[model samples]
Target chain A: MSELLNTLMQDARVWQGHRHNKTTTPSESTGYQLLDNQLGGIGWPRGALSECLVDQPGIGEIHLLLPLMQRLTGTGKTVFWLNPPHTPYAPALAREGINLDQVVMIQTGDGGDFLWTLENCLRSPVTGLVMAWPGKLATRDIRRLQLASESGSNVCVLFRERRYTDQNSPAALRLELTPGDHQDLKINVIKRRGSWPGQRCSLAMAHRADLAFRETPQVVQGPWHQSRR
Target chain B: MLWLYLHFPHLLLDHIRRDRQDQRPLVIVEGTGQHVLQACPEARNRGVQTGMRLKTAVTLAPELGIVRAQPEQDARILEDQARWLYRYAAHITLVSPDGLLAEIGSLQKLYGGLPAVWQTVEQALDEHRLTAWAATGHTPLAARLIARAGKGECTGDRGHILRTLETMSLATAEFDAKTCTRLQRLGLNTLGEVFALPAPELARRLSPEILAHIQKIRGTRPDPQAPWQPPHSFRQQADFVQEIEHSQGLLFPLQRMLSELEDDLCWRQQDTDSLHLILQHRHEEDTRLRIRTSGPEHRADGFLNLIRLRLEQQPLRAPVVALVLSVKRFIGREAPAGQDLLGKSQDLNEAWHTLISRLQARLGDHALKRLSPQEDHRPERAWSASEVQSKHKPRLTNPEHLPRRPLWLLQGPQPLTEPPTAWFSGPERISGGWWDGERVHRDYYIAQLRSGQLAWVFRDVREGWFIHGWFG
Candidate 1:
C-alpha cells in the first residue's frame, strides 16, 4: 500500500495527460490549437528533420509548412529549398507572409550535388529551415541530413511523393498530406517524436465560393465539346 | 636614416619549393643555360652546388627537379614581397632581382624598437617558410651590401656600422669587374681599406662609378631610391613543380598566399568581397572561378572553405601548372563589431555575417538572396531578389486587410476549361503592360473548383477564364 501511494504520486503528471515533460523537446508553436495539443511539446520540435509525404504535388503541401517558414524567415533567418519540383512563385510565397528575400531555392542536376547542398544548408548556423523534395532517396541520405541539422538551430522538412510512405524515416515528424472530403487538407500524422502518431487533422484551405458563380456556364463548357467534335 | 634590407638569394627556388609537401631534391637553374642558381638542402646533400652544370647535378641526384628561373616572374614576385613589407613600413623600395629595402628609422617609435620590427618580419617569413637574409644599416646601400654578402647584423651605433662595413671585402661590393681588378692592383681588399685613401687619389685610381658606390656605402653621397607603391589590387601566383591534376593539391600554396593576404587586409583594416582564382592549365585555356562572399570577408579559412567546395564541384579540366589568386574588390570595413562591456565575446551580428558569407562561398554567390518588394504591380515584377544582406529585422510594412493572393503561382497560367462551381471572392481587375508587347487584362477571383481545390483564376477581357495559381 505504501509503494502504491509513492507510485501514484510519481505518476501524477501522467494522470494529467502531460507525461512527456522530460522527454519532449523544446519547440516553436505549430500555430494550430488542435494539432499543437496532440504534439508532445504542443509545437514543432526545433533542430530536427521532419518529413511531409504527399499523394500529389499541389494539394496545399507548401501551405502546411508556410506558417513555420514565415516565423523563421521573419526573424531574419534564411530558408533554403533544394531542387524544388515547381518554380518557387515568389509572389505566392510573399502572400503567405514569408519574406520573399529569405527564400533561397537551389537547383542541382546531379543527385550527389543535391544531397551535398542539402547537407550544407542544413548545417548552416543561420539557416532557419531546409526543405528538399528530392523525389526518392535512400534512408541513409535522409539520415545524413538529419545528423547535419541536429547540431544547429534549424529544422529540415523533406517533401516526398506519397508512394514512399511505407519506408521507415529518421525524421522527428512524418506528416502525410492528401486532399480530404470537401477539399480540406487531410494530414495524417505518421510520426511525431515523443508522442503517439495516429491522429488525422483536416484544415479548411480556401474560402467557399458564393452562389452566383457556383454553376458552370454553358458557353464556357463548349470548348471541350467543340474540340471533341 | 635606419634602413632594413631583405635579400632573397634563393627567391626562385624558395618560391618553387615553399608550399610543396614533399621536400625532394630540387634546384633552380638559369633559363637559357644549364647552370644551377639555387639548390635545396636535399640537393646540397647530394653534392649539388650553385653554378654547377645541370647535367652534373642530375647525375648526382637522379630525381633532382631543375626549375628554370624566369626573370619577369621573379621580378613580379619580388614586388609582391614588397607589397606585404609595405604593411610594416610606409616607405618601401624594391631592390631588384630578389631583395627589398624599407626605411625603418621612423617606425622605431611605433614598433617600440628595431628588434620588435625585426622579430615581426622574421616571424612573417618563418610563417610562410620563405628563405630571407635581413640586415639593418644607416643607409639602404650598406644594408643591401651586407645582406648580399650574408653578413646581416643590426648595428645600433654609427661606429658599429662603420666597423661592420670595414669588414666587408671589396669582392662583395657591387662595383664593376674593371674597377674591382684595378682596386685589387692597388692592393685594396676591404671597403674600409679602399676608401681610407685621400679622395683625389682614390678618384685617380677608381672610376667615378666605384667612387659613387663607396660614398653611398659610407653614407656621404645622396642615394635616391624610388619608393614602390602597392598596386590597387592583390595578385599572387605559385607554380607547382609537377602539374597538379587534382584541385585538392593546390590548397597549400593557396593557404600561404591567402593568409598573407589576410595579414595585408588586417594591416589596412579592410575586407574583400570576392576572390578571382585562375588555374593555369597545361593544355587548355586558364580556368577561372570567381568566389563572391555575401559581404566583406577577411578570414583566410573562410575563403579557403569556399574554394574547396567549388573545386569539389568543378574539378580541373586539364593538369594545372600554376594558380593565380587575385582580389580587386575591397570593401572598407565600417565600425567593426565591438566586444561587450564585460569581456570580449563573439558579436551576434558579426557571427551571422560570417555564417552567411561562408554559406555564400560553398554555394555560389547566387545561392543566398534577400527579397525586397518592388513597386511594380505586375505579379511577376512584384518582388526582386536583393543580393544585399538582411542583417536587421525587415522594416517592410505588410499591412493587413489586403486582397488575399495564392501561395503558388504556376510558371505560366493554365487555361481554365470551365467556370468554378463556387466563387468565394474577387472580381479584382488587373490590367497592365500596355507599353510592353505582352499586354494582360484580366479580372481575377479566388474560386473553389469542382475538384474541391481553391484556384487563383482570372478571366481575360477578350479571351476566356484561366487558372493563374493555387491558393494553399
Candidate 2:
C-alpha cells in the first residue's frame, strides 16, 4: 500500500507538468504594438480561455474584442456570442473591421444553457471562437471549458464576468480591467499558465475619431523606473 | 361591310397547346353561383358566352372545361409584361386584360414610321404567344373602335380610319341607344356621317358627349390616360450564369447584392423594415425567404447576420438560378449627431437602435419584441409589442414606473416548483384582465437567491408560483 501511494505521488507530478506546459498557439500581432508587447507579444493568447473583468461600461472591453473578432472573422471563421447581456452596436463593430456577418449571437435563458451552447460551438471546426457573458460561473464549470478549449485547437472561448466571484478558476488567463484615472485604463493580471502573475499596468486610451475601436495603449512611463524613483 | 370581330378568346389554349389536356374548350368562371364572369375564346366558339347560364353551357357543350379566373394573378402577369414592353416603347398603357395601347407618336421616328411601330408591337406580342390588332387615329375612341373591328391587315392612315368608321356598324361604334336614335334622326347611319357634321352644329344638335366622341375619333383632343407606376420598393437581383446547388456558392453573389442594397439605403437616408430574398429555380417557380427586422435598419452587417441566421436554420429548397433582395418598407433614419464634451453622455435613441439590431440578429423579428406602454394604469396590460409601421416610438408617459419594471420579462408566467428564502421580499399583488380569458391574480417578489443573484418571481392565488425574470 505504501509503494502504491509512492507511485501515485510520482504520477501526480507528471500531470502537474502537463498542465504547466499549456502554451498558447502562435497568433498574429494585434497591430497595437505596445499593447501586443505587454500581452506576451502575441494576440489574446490563442486556443485558451481568457477572462476579461470590467467594472465600468465603455472603458476598453469592446475595443479589445474588436481586433480579436476582426482577425477571426477576417479569416472566414465563425464567432459565436453566447448570451451577451449588453447589446452590441452593429455600426460601431463594422467600423472596427469585424465582419459582423460572421458573428452569431445566441441569447440563452439561463447560464446553464449558455455554457452548453458554448461547448457545442467549440466542438465545430468551422467555429473560430465563442464569447459568453455568464453573470457568475463556478470554478468546475471553468475547468470543463478549459479542457474543451484545449481539445478544440481552432477555437477559443472568452467569459466576461459581470460580478466578482471568489472560487478558484482554471482559466488560462484572468485579467481584471478597471477604468483609469484619466483617458486611460488599468489592467491587472490575476493568473497566467506557466508564467508569474504580471504587475498592474497603466496606459493611455484614446478613441479613434473615424473608427470605432479605441487606440492601443501607449506607455507614458516605464513601470519599473516610475516606481523606483 | 360584314365586320367579323373574331376575338380569338382562346389565346391561352394556343399557348398551352403542348399541355393538350388543358386545351378542351375551357371557360374562366369567377365567383360563385349565378354571377358568371368570363368565357375563353374556345368557349365562345362553342356558343358558351359570358353571362350565359352555367347549366346551359354545360348542356350545350358537354366537353367544355372550366377554370377560375384570378384577376390578381392576371394583373401581376400583365404588369410584368408591361415592364418588358417599356424597353420597346417609352409609354405603354394596359387597355384591358389582353389589350395594350402604346403611344407610337414619338416611336414613329425611331422605328422609321407608324407601320414600323405597329410591327414592333406585333413582334412583341408574338414573343409572348399573344396576337393584338392595333389601329392609330386622331382620337383614342376612333382608334379603339378600329382596333376592336379586327382589321389587323389594314394600315391605319387618315383615309383608312375614315373608311373604317364609314363601314363600321352602329353596334360596333360603342354608342348608347339614345345617342344612336339621335344620330339616326340626324340621318347619320355611320361614324363618318357624325364626323362630316360641323363641330358647332354637331354640338348644338347633340350633347357635348356626342360631339366629344366625334372629336376623339377625329384626333382633335388629347387622349388622356393614367400610366401604370411600379411599386415604391428597392429590389437588388443577381442572375447566375450557371445554377448553384450549394449555399456557399450563393454567398458571394448575395453579399454583392446586399452591399448594393446597403448603398441604396444609405443614399436614400432610410432604413428597411423587412427584406425578402427571392430564389428563382432553374425550372420551378421562385421561392421567397423573408428576413424582417425588429426595428428599421440600414447597416449591412446587421442585415447580413440576420440572413446568415435564417439560412443556417432553413436551407434552400432547390438549386437557385437567380437571387433577388427586395425591401418592402423604408423608414427615415435619424442617427445621433456628435455632442459636446460637457453635455449628457448617453444618447438613448442610439443605444435603443443598437439593442434592437443586436436582438434582431440573434432572435428573429418575431422573437425580439418591444413593450410599448399603452394608455392603461394596470401594470399587466401597460405595455404591448409595437406594431409594424413607419414610426414606432414607445409611449412611456410614466417614467417613474419604468425604472421599477424589469427590462426582460417572460412572455408568459413560468410555473415554479417551490418558493421562499431569506433573500425573497414581500409579494406585490397585481390582478387584472377580467374581460379577457387570461385573468391574473399574482403576487410578484424581488428575490435574491442563495448565490446572491437577484430574480423576479411571482405567486398566483390558484396556479401557485412562477419565476419571471432576472436582474443582471
Cα RMSD to native, each candidate? 4.6, 16.1
Candidate 1 lDDT by residue in tens digits, A1-229: 9998788878845454555445657577766666676665456677788888875544666766777898988886778877776556665566567776667766665677678777767766667877888876999988887788787767778888788888888888888888754556788889987667888888754332222333332223322223411
Candidate 2 Cα deviation (angstroms), residue B364: 1.5
lDDT of 1 by residue, B282-397 (tens): 77999998987766789999888878877886878999998999989888887655657753333545556666665565556665555545555666665566554546555564
lDDT of 2 by residue, B53-126 (tens): 78888887788765545555455445545654666765666755555555666666788876677677678667
lDDT, candidates in the order shown: 0.76, 0.59
- lDDT tens readout by residue for model 2, A43-162: 565556878776544455555565667887787566666665554433334445555445566666666655655665555555676677777677788788777676665435464553
- Candidate 2, residue B144: CA error in Å? 1.1
| Candidate 2 wrong stretches, greater than 4 Å | A1-67, A70-80, A84-229, B1-35, B40-51, B56-101, B110-116, B119-133, B152-156, B181-211, B220-362, B365-472
Pairs with steric clashes in candidate 1: A101-B370, A101-B371, A209-B423, A209-B424, A210-B423, A214-B421
Best by DockQ: 1
